[model samples]
Target chain A: MLDLALKSIMRSKTRSFLTTFGIVIGITAIVALGSVSEGLRIQISEALEMAAGLIYVYEESDQPLFLAMASSSLSEEKIQEIEDVGGIKESARFVMDIAYLDGDQQFGQPDLFINGVDPENEELLVTESAELDDGETLEGGDAYSATIGYSLAQDLDIGVGDTIELKEENFVIVGVYKKIGDPGLDNGVLIPIETALDLLDTEEYSGIIVYPEDLDDVEEITDYINENIEGVTALSTEDVAITISSVIDQIQIFTFGIAGISAIVGGLGVLNTMIMSIMERKREIGIMKAVGATNNCILQQILTESVIITFFGGLAGVILGSLGAYSLRFISSALESATVTPSLAIGSLIFAVLLGLLGGFYPAWKASKLDPIEAIRYE
Target chain B: MSKTIIEVKDVKKVYNQGKPNELVVLKDIDMKVNREEMIGVFGPSGSGKSTLLHIIGCLDRPTSGKVYIEGKDVSGLTDDELALIRGQKIGFVFQQFNLIGSLTALENVEMPMRICNVEKRKAIKRAKKLLSSVGLGERINHLPSQLSGGEMQRVSLARALANEPDIILADEPTGNLDSKTGKEIINLMEELNKKGFTFVIITHDPLIAKCASRKLNIKDGKIWR
Candidate 1:
């Protein structure tokens, strides 16, 4: 019976291919869109990872968009108070925000992330990833120098010894950080905390990253900072990842909504093709029925053909969708270098199979119920 | 007494029973066939020949009478049971040489036996032998479209004989063939019948009617000896 169905499909190659193409398009869209959420979640989780025993403290007043918004800052006295806690071993101050070059501001070009790190904690809390890929490091008192990440240097077409104007202040490029595989870090510009504060016109640091003496004290220390510090929130590494995931969950719902449209059209395509094919093979079906094929046999044959078309469609869709996801990298520049790493999704294949079965049942049933005498006489 | 293989009892067939455009194709048809009897039905077009053949072949149920095959009354059988009985006992050869176009000659011959749950290796061997018996051995791999009209009929005959059916109901078996090719098919049927296979052939050809051991003519939805 399976062989017969295969022979029938091979007998009409063009129709079979055209029918399968509909499923292919739907599965491709599903896998491609699903990969975007998967890729971003992975990158964000990786970026959230740092030295394990550290806690990040941000000025808080119920601000949910932690990555982009920071309206207030922590005064030096507050940082001292947090550092004075029992388990703290080291600390670093950061002033983070979006920034554009002087020429970019004049031309209305977009801004890259500007990350300010305390010069005294440069080696400890900062530069924990790798060595400089180009040029020299900043001197202890080189207040106007900035070190950029690898992708930033490549994107801006700037290197060591070039002077960049940050607002009204001029800073020389000191070094370029090596590629760390995290897009957020790979596209950021790192400057001294004092220079960044002067340029942004802020008098204090926006956040403080503290390291505890014992890794086991992280949760307790986080709780202490949140409870003891005034108007502040302290998040551990896992907490930050969880927070980002909740945001991504909403976006994932949106992605699935888009993929849902493709599924309906693909299923309709299967239904239309199967019905037309059955109409053409009316006499042939009657012949089979007259030759001793039961209603169940006919039903299984048609359903088998449809399932085979969609199974191969799903297989092809997975490969094509992964390639589509990989193409997202080339267009990431327009998206401020929010790079995507393509990942294959197995769930989409299962969805395609279910679609095929549900879509194929009605046509198969109609075919199985056909009266042999009438069908054999059909023109 | 010879064993009665099939009997049609007072069968009246009505089409669209309650509708304004209703048709009554077969009225009060009665028939009986003993084992190994070659019965030929003679009729013109729309004279209920095919309709009678359909009932006798178990492809359809009678509208108001009973049909018995191999001494078993089939009036109470479900569609699936009737299908099984057809698969096991009745073989059909149509005027159009109704072979599945996608299957090769050997595969077409194997279809009924496969449906009857014949084992794979045995079915293949038997199908090969049946095709060779019908002089289609050389064209066993050919599709229905690849064969000539007469050759397609030969393949159709091999297919009808696949499961060693108790009765072969041929509805104008050679109707579509040229006269010369038609002669070949008629000769083949004669040879098969001489080997003791019962056949019921419906044809307008005077030769087939004469060739049969018995003849019945149907006209205007009634049958007469």
Candidate 2:
């Protein structure tokens, strides 16, 4: 029966290919888009873990995460109060903002993600800028000396001792940090807090980083600050990661909405093609029935043909979608990066087959119900 | 002492019944076909020869009577049950040759045996033997379009014998062929009948009818001696 169905499909090569093409396009959209979304989420979740053991102390606000993090002001007195708590492993003032360099820069994108660090703090609360690949970390009482991240140095052709103009002030690049696999820290620039306050014209720090000596003290510390500090909110890194991941999930759900529409269109294409194919072969169905084929047998034959088409379409879609994901990384680096997951590809493949069964059911059933006598007589 | 292979008792068939066009194609027809007999049903178009053949072949149920095939009452069977009887006990050849054009001659012959769940290797061997017996051994791999009308009919004949059925019903098997090719099909039917294969050949051609051992005339939905 499978052989007969295959022969029948092969005889009408054009129709079979057009039907399969619909499934392929739909699956490709699902897999490629899903992979890019998944890849960006992974990169972000990994980056979010950079603050794993530290607690962020800031004034409470409902702004979006990145903006809230940069705008949460903590004065010197507030930072001192948070550091005085027990189980504390030294804390430092943290200031962060988006900055733009003056004049021409390599790659033409002069915008830089900046973190204001106070080198005077023996324990740099923000551990991301503690290590340097070239030159030294910012010196105590350093003025206008900046440490840049590895990717920024490469993009802007700046090295240690080179002067970078920020807000009309020339600052010496004292160090370039090593690649830590966190895009925010790997591509960021760190400057002394005093200079950041002077250049950006902001006297107050954005927030204070609080370090608990023990990992188990994180919950107690966060609860203490949120309850006792009145206006300040304390959040663990995990809380931030969950918030960001849910945001990514919303994006993923949006992607699925688009992929689902394409899949529905593909299903309708299969329905149209199968109905036309069955209508053309009504006489052939009659011949099979006249030769002793039961209704179940005829139904199985038609269903198997549709499944065969989708199975091959799914296979081709996987191959093409993986390549498309790879090319998408190069074509549009909108996020951190894109990586195709095996589970997502497999899911798309299964979806393709289910699409076939859904679209082929009614047509197959109708063909099976045809009367053999009248069918044989149908021209 | 021959056993009855097919018995149609007071069978009636009506098209568009109880409506304005209410045509009765087969009216209370009675027939008996014994084993290994070549019963030719001769009739012009619009007669009920084909309808009677359908009732006996288990392709259609009689509206008002009973049909027994090999002593089994098949008229009361469901469509699926009738399909089993058709697969196991009866084979049919149509006027257009009715071959599935996608399959080769050998595959066409193998169709019924496959439908009946005959073992693959054994069915292939039997299909080859049947095709060769019908003088189509060399053309087994050729599709129906590649074969001539007489060759296509011969392929259909091989297919009819594929499942080793108890009866073979040929409905105007030579209707689409020229006289020469038609004669060849008639001669093949005669030779197979002589080898103890029961046949019910329906035709309007007198020359083809002459090959059967007995002939019954049908006109305007009634059978007469």
Candidate 3:
């Protein structure tokens, strides 16, 4: 019977192909969509963890959480005090301000995140946003040297040796920062910390970058800062990681919404194909039953066929979808952008196959329960 | 002197009960067939012959009345139980041959034994022997579509005999064949019957009926012995 069933399935190549096609499409959608979304979430979270200068310091204040939540500034004195904690090597006060790119393009003003730090310790706190194509680094007493992200250079139609006007002052594009594995890095701008602080014209800084002599003592130093310091919230690498994870969680909720829709569409296709296949094989089913096939046998035959289709389709979909997602990552990376991870590839494929199986179930059952005599009698 | 293998007592079949379109097909059908007996049921179209065959073959249940195969009452059995009985005791050969078109003759013949839980190697061996018994040894690898009507019927017969069933129910077995092919099929059946295989054949042809050991004519769901 098993042999016959297998042979029967193999005999109708076209029908089987059509049935498998629906399953394949469904599975592919699940795997590819899942992989790309997971990849995006990972890339974003990783970028947030590696944030160069953004800092959150803890201090003893009347309302610490409120102060952390507030858009108000942290005093330079408080920043300096936090910088004096044990294991702290050097600290730079950073001001969050935007620098509009002077360009030849016809778009609205694209403001880059221009950060401020001390000229002596600028390199300690400020990491390049993109790899330099052809450029020079910042130097003291030189008012024109500034590093710009790769995308910023492209947006402003400026490159190394080109001049970019910052706040009505023309600055030479001395260096292009390296492109990080993030989209946000594409538009960031870096300059001498003192230069930015003077340009923003504020004694109060948005945040302060703290460097610890012993990286392992970062937690203890953060705890000491919270206990002795005033008017700020301390944020360690772990805290940043948690915050990025939560942000990614929110992103996931939205991605899941899209994935959920894709799953439903795929499931519907599976159900539709199973139902149509059942209808087409009604007479054949009845004939089997009339020849002494029990209801279980009939059901098993139909269910097995459904499962087979689902399993094959799911497998194919997974391969194709993963390939697509992987290929997309390659293309993006070749253009020097973030990519989806290969680790999430399997989850999508398995999900696709499961979708096929779940979708095929009810229709297969319906096909199995059909009265054999009536089925045989059906034209 | 042969032992009775099938007994149907006062079986009834009704369609669409309690509805305006309700129709009765079989009313109190009673019959008995001994082991190795070749019994032909002759009837016109819509004469409840197929229904009788269905009940006797255990493919369907009688609305009322007991059907006993090999001395066991099967009317109250579940569909699965009926399938076991059919697989173990009853072989069916349909007018259309009913061989799965996808499978070659050998595979189709091996199907019943496989359903009966026969091991693959043994089932294949048995099927090959039966195919040869039906004079289809050379065409064992041929699909149903590739075989002639007579050859297909032979494969169908081989499939029916796969589990060594106690009774064979052939419903209009040669109705679709040419006269020469139909005669050839009837001869194959007769030879198998002589070897002690019980048969219940439903046919409209008098010549086909004449080949059986006993003849029962049916009209409007009533049987005339």
Candidate 4:
């Protein structure tokens, strides 16, 4: 029966190929887009863990979370109050903003943002994975010194001793950080806090980073700051990671939803193909019935044919989608930080076959229910 | 002293019952076919010969009568049961030489045996022997499209004998062939009948009908034996 089904599909080469192409497109979209989204989520989670020891204290506002993180509601006094919290080991006041840099293009786009870090608290601000690739770290009270991330340095075609213009200020590149696999940190520049204030013309710091003496002290210190500090919100690193995780999950759902729509369209293509096949093979089915083929046998044959179409389509899609994901390096530089290798999971393959089965069911049932005599008489 | 292989009692068939355009295709049909008997049912088109053959072969149910195959009542059998009976006890040859286009001649012949759960080796051996016996040994590997009309009908005949069924129900087996090809098919049936294979052939062709040992003429849904 399966052999016959395969032969029938081969008999109509163009129609079968077109139907399988629909499934290919759908599975490609799902795997490629899903890999990218999953890659972003993984990178974000890793970045969060990398900064796990630090709690961020910022002003509470009605603004969006990202904008709220960028604009400081914290004053110098608020920083003092956060530092005065019990169990706090160290604190850093920094300003961060998206600033256009005048340099060579990375991934055909200008460099992302600049972070203003106090030279005194540079050690606490830079993640542990970061290492100076060239030049030297910023010294206390260094005015206009900038450290560029590894990818940014490569993108801009600049190294130590070179200068990049940020918001009309030419800052000499003092150091370059190694590739840290964090996009936000890898594509941005780090400058002196005083220079950032001088350039952005803002006196208030964007936020304060507080370190706890022990892992157990993190939540305690966050609660204490939230209680003592007025009009400011203190969040443990875990809380921040959870928020980011939820946001990533939402994005994943949206991406998968879009992919699902394409898959459904692909399923409809299967349905159409199966219906046409049944209609064309009406007499053939009648002949089979007359030769003692039970309805179940006919049903199995049709379902098997549908599954074979989708199964091959799914395999092809996985290959294509993996290629698409890998090809991201040639298309975008941002993906270099969070390069996600697409995985062809067994679940997805099963899902594809199930889609074929579902799409082929009604048509197969109709074929099985056909009256043998009438079908035999059908032209 | 041959036992009856097929017994049809007071059979009637109606299409679209309780409707204004009702069609009564078969009425008051009664017949008994003995073992190894080649009974030819002759009629023009729409004379219900095929309908009666279908009822006797358990492919269709008679609306108002009982059908007995090998002394077992099959009137109220389920579709699956009917299919089993057809698979194990009956074989069908249609006017169109309804060979599955995708399968080769050998596969077509082996289909009924396979459905009856015959072992693969045994079924293949039987199919090969049947095809060779029908003078189609060289054509077993050919698809229906590759075979000539006479060759395709020969393949169909070989397929009908695949399970060594008790009865072969052939409806206009040579209807699509020219006179020369039709003669060849009729000769094959007569030879098989001589080998003690029971047959019920429905045809309007007098030449084909003359080959049967017994004749039953059907007209306007009634049979005159």
- Residues A1-379 of candidate 2: C-alpha lDDT, one tens digit per residue: 6777788778889988988888888888888888878897877666556567778777778887766776788777877888788888867786777665554455633367677777765235436534678888777326888888777787689899898777687778888887655555566777887778877777677888777889899989889888888667888877777788888899899997898788779888888888998999999898888888888777888888888888788878878888888888666435337777878888888888888888888889988888898899988
For TM-score, candidate 2 versus 3, the one ahead is: 2
Tens digits of per-residue lDDT for model 2 on B1-225? 449988888889998888999989998888899888998898888898888988888888877889888778887887788888888888899999999888899999998898888887888899999999999899999999999999999999999988778899999998899999999988888889889899999987788666677898999888988
lDDT of 1 by residue, A1-379 (tens): 6677788778789988987888888888888777778767766665566445568887876658564235658888887888888898788888877666544554433456677887667644443655678876554438888887788889889888887666767788888878654554566777888888888888788888888888799999999989987877888877877887998898878887788678768888778878888888899888888888888888988888888888888878877877777786687653332323333356787777877887788899999899998898888
TM-score of chain B of each: 0.96, 0.97, 0.97, 0.97
Between prediction 3 and prediction 4, which has the larger DockQ? 4
* Native A-B contacts reproduced, model 3: 0.43
Candidate 4's C-alpha runs over 4 A off are A103-110, A118-123, A129-145, A160-175, A192-195, A337-351, B1-4, B110-126, B194-196, B205-213
What are the Cα lDDT values of the candidates? 0.80, 0.82, 0.73, 0.84
TM-score of chain A of 1: 0.87
- Candidate closest to the true structure, highest DockQ: 2
DockQ: the better of candidates 2 and 3: 2
* TM-score per candidate, chains pooled: 0.83, 0.88, 0.78, 0.89
State how far residue A170 of model 4 sits from its true place (Å): 5.6
Question: B109-146 in candidate 1: lDDT tens per residue?
Answer: 88888777788789899999999998988989998989
Candidate 3 A-chain TM?
0.75
Candidate 1 vs candidate 4: which has greater TM-score? 4
Per-residue CA lDDT of model 4 for B30-137, tens digit only, reads 899999899888888899988898899888998899899888999999877888888878989988898988889999998888777788789889999999999999
Which candidate has the top score in lDDT? 4
* CA deviation > 4 Å runs, candidate 3: A1-30, A44-55, A58-73, A81-91, A96-115, A118-192, A199-202, A210-234, A327-343, B18-22, B44-46, B114-126, B217-223
